[model samples]
Target: MKPENPLTIGIDIDGTVTEPSSIVPLMNESFGKQLRYEDCIDYNLATVYGISDEVFADWLDKHGERLYDVAPVHGAADRVLRQWYKRHKLVYISAREARHLEVTIKWFSRYQIPYHHMDLIGSHDKLAAARKWQVDLFLEDRLENALQLAEALSIPVFLFDTPYNQGTLPRLVQRVTSWEQVDALVDQLALEKANA
Candidate 1:
């Protein structure tokens, strides 16, 4: 069955649409620390890298734009999002600073990622933005953000699986390993909504 109303999907850009490990190489080269994506068992990179928060913040301040400029899309993300672009409104709600918007937009253009709207909230708290957008579903890579959005918005959230986000999840938050799985789940959701 076709969707009666286009679902507004709130998506996270960095680690959700982009490869979760896409920043690893840049960080490794910048700080001269040998770090692999698998070694990132904690979402807090400062904790994972054993660096002070100030140090990490400084690094991000200096390199965040370039990081966004070069980060690669996650596997199958381009294909899946392009398909959904036809049926739903994809709103990218990211924690990146508003200053990074230009690079972010350029990144999307460079990669041909599809989005109907984009919001760089500049912080991890996205409840307000999600509410404003009236999202029916959300996609995220951060465990905290996923849990918060799922509980607060009462919306189903697809949490992209990452080494860092292995914590227990609430029923509303589903862990997905790839964009292919996400695509299938979205199809199931549309069917369920149609049935209802």
Candidate 2:
């Protein structure tokens, strides 16, 4: 549901707003594994690929920048987000490290993704940021994070569906597959709040 004030929406970046499989090609090339997005049932690539954490870290250190730089935006996200930005507070709370803030902002600018606030929290624990911002709703891709945020904040979370997150979700956590669905859901939430 919406609030009396403009809704503050907390959004995840990587697999949510960006092309869901944006990093798969890079990961495949880097690790010599031909894996598809549906094959990734876990968030940790190292585990999914059966590589050591140190090797994963080393690979990231070498290619992370390029990956982020070229990652594509999900279709219609720019238009929908820009529309929402006019009436709501769009807060991007990413698990990307604090050091990547500049590049992240640059990526947004490059892609023309509208946002009011950006927080590089460096981890998947986004509850604090959501609480701090008083986010009325959250859009996410990580199942664990969505579950935790919805349960902890007592708010609805629109989980962007991915193979990695295909599972039963709580009533408060709705699985969405497209930006159009997200926009419609937000409108429905606002209508429900207005009626309430």
Best by TM-score: 1
lDDT of candidate 1 over 56-156, digit per residue (tens): 99999999998898888899999899999888889999999999989998888888888999999989999999999999999999999999999998999
Stretches of candidate 1 off by over 4 Å are 1-3
TM-score of each candidate structure, all chains considered together: 0.96, 0.94
> Which clashing pairs does model 2 show?
none
How do the residues 14-92 of candidate 2 rate in per-residue lDDT, one tens digit apiece? Answer: 8888888998899999888899988988878899999998998888878877887889998789899988987788999
Clashes of 2: 0
Clashes of 1: 0
